[model samples]
Target: MELLAWGNTELDSSWSVTEKSNCSYIRIYHLTSGSICYSDTAMSCALDTEAVYILPSHAPFTMKPAPGTDTHCTWLHMNIYPVLVKELLSIPYTQKQALLFSLMRCIMEEAYPPAASLSHCAEIFIQDLYQMGCLEKPDPAFSPVLDYLCVHFSEDISISDTARQFGYTPEHFIRKFKKETGSTPYQFLTGYRMGKCCELLRKGYPVSSVCALTGYHDIKTFDRAFKKYHGRTASEYQKYFKKIYP
Candidate 1:
């Protein structure tokens, strides 16, 4: 999923919204107070209290905010870029909301211009919700396995092992993983490792230590992938880098 735009807004008593055309974006709303009616092609729900809503991309939606002395909700608009999660979701108060609140603070404060850090925070928040079994289960064909890959990216995982874990044959696993993620499992693992390397290196981890901790067998191979993926060496990034999660 790709984050397109995010911010917070409070609609007062006179709040209003109109029906619109097709939407290529998924909207997330956290009702801090008051209420609103949300409707789309696939589902319709009310943000009547302290609740969170995740609307699907490409599903047109209209908002009908309730009128009162004090009425408001905060919303986030994200472009899945390609639809990953398959349904609209409304999650009520839960422990996971604490994580969402933390991420919201990061998105609001740390993500001033909204770059990689913001994306990373948002992804983490959403993934938490998914793991909480709140959002509609993802595409059964590949979504669950993708989640497994994301959560366990740091572990020494193999395609054959993961495929078998997901009850798929090795041959079928390669095809499905490639088709859904646009990269083989190994390639995706490498990319995830590299992203983590960037994160750690930027955080002042020593080169040799980072290499070893990131599961790199040697600095040479690590350097190769780092330079190839980031177009710069790890040390270079540490000296002149901004936290961007890619």
Candidate 2:
């Protein structure tokens, strides 16, 4: 499932893993006095008043609470952008921003309506993401960088080179880039690389060849990073997604 929308309304005294990874659903569960363990080998972190989690698509995981556990909380799921997540982390630790969570609720409410407007909800969500420091408008020069990245994702490009080409010092360019894109040049480049890697893998490219084509130094590192970001090794991901490529 695409995980279009989801949230918890009334608090559940306790709930177990009825189903997991059937949908890309991440949720917030408020625990009254006990903790809920979510995962067998994966690790999760608490977000706010409740423990928040993001379940990667197709990744197997489990959730169970301690005996007598009682909790009240809301859960949400979204197709999030990596840049947006980076923006949220860039905010001051003390800041409590619920832009993403709030947007999910609004989208869900309208998702089933006779005249649901998901695109409108997306536009509003982008605004919320910007307001919450979870997204930012790219600088005018950023388009060049984006264009270059699109064409040369397989090349090893550095921020310093990109900065020089744009007539800005590395420090200045890095700051302006982050201000506009909510991600450092390195982070954005990696995201681009990962995206291309996914496409190449799904197109039936050999793992080692994909590593070379994607500018990864070696297959080992590429495999590790692929699993880290996509929750599946390149081979496994390709096995599932490759047939879908036309």
Candidate 3:
């Protein structure tokens, strides 16, 4: 795991520029612009609107602003290795991926002010970030364990099964996983499932569907666990997100 830094810069008036990536990089650009051009191409896209674009590593790119233009945007640059990116894209793309990047961009923008620090907020954000992206390939043994939890998250997976897949004894696996992720396999799985349940409920999925999709054998068990982990009933959680996010 890497602690990446993020920041933004504003171009003065209108300008055209080119830059090189010292190492392979991936950039997510959130732009609000009247008009912009990339390289020699004229950008006829809508102006002064929200848009997102991806720039692959080491790709020479150019940007031009329309006359009398006033534009602003945030650029998130992750010095992602190719292997890591390939693994990240291995999973089916989901809106969660975009939201994860957006929140990260927000975090970098907000600068983690110490005065307003909140553990709950930090926990939720970090969990979402981990859930959104996959680790690079040839990762540590624990990396596969974590990835398995995420991909098979809807299944009733067990610590022993996770350990077996990684060719480690159950006891040894548990200790190493805890050391690396700061949570036991069971604890991590439960948290991951709970987070997915929240996402499903927010999308207005029915309780029965969320239960079935999240590997809960019964509605009673699902409701109980969801309430226990989130401190609210499923219905209450859905309503809460609607009000907060809408």
Candidate 4:
């Protein structure tokens, strides 16, 4: 995981925001004073000052502060795996606040926070969430394929061959994978690779090395895909993180 941006803002009663959808990063907000009504297609609720709200990637949402009241907030934007969003949301409010505040302090206290320290905190928080039984177990039949991809993502993968190895036909594998994971195998692999690319970049890996580490042999292809996936070239992404934390 990587911290993309952080802000502490005070907004008046007139403040509101509407987004057709959030971008690639996850958004987290803690209101220090007042409240806001948050609504998405699935649910609507008042976000109170004592709680934290984590809006996952690509979710459509809106926020409007209570009438006639000013609001104070601390917010963070981060790059993390989308699969973990569900689990993160399931964590209890107090636990979420504790973990998030620690993360905020790590970034705010230092002129130049170490990237590895941030990554380590994120990893530990994720592990604690899992230990709390927030994650849903994967379907037994699909677990093998998921495990394979997790271990072999840095290798050149062939969908057809992978299906055969796992006792599935390519057509059936595509269908079943989509049914189980809400994404096709290729989409999942690419998403995983791009996420790893970001993590490696934040760890100070050079672009050329990160490309090879993420299994893209062709530099040109990696460059194009990186730009498309992240809205910035690999070098630019690396430089952005360095400028913020180096």
Top lDDT model: 4
lDDT of 4 by residue, 77-141 (tens): 66654343431252345876576665766566677766556556555655665687643444777
lDDT of 3: 0.54
TM-score, candidate 2, is 0.49
Estimate the TM-score of every prediction. 0.47, 0.49, 0.45, 0.70
lDDT of 1 by residue, 158-193 (tens): 788888998889999898865665456776667556
lDDT of 3 by residue, 114-222 (tens): 2122223333433444565533233375566677778998887877877887898999988877566545566566766776776677568988999999989999999
Q: Judge candidate 2 against the unseen true structure and give its global Cα lDDT, from 0 to 1.
A: 0.54
User: With candidate 3 superimposed using the best TM-score fit, by how many Å does residue 41's alpha carbon deviate from the native?
Assistant: 59
> What digit string (tens of lDDT, one per residue) describes model 2 on residues 113-157?
321343344445445546865443455556877677657777778
Off by over 4 Å in 3: 1-141
Considering TM-score, which of the candidate structures 2 and 3 is the better prediction for this target? 2
On a 0 to 100 scale, what is the lDDT of residue 5 in model 2? Answer: 30
What's model 1's lDDT at 41? 67
Order the candidate numbers by TM-score, best to worst: 4, 2, 1, 3
Clashing pairs in 4: none
How do the candidates rank by lDDT, highest first? Answer: 4, 1, 3, 2
Whole-model alpha-carbon lDDT for candidate 1? 0.65
Off by over 4 Å in 2: 1-136, 242-246
Candidate 1 TM-score, C-alpha based:
0.47
RMSD of each: 10.7, 10.2, 16.0, 4.5
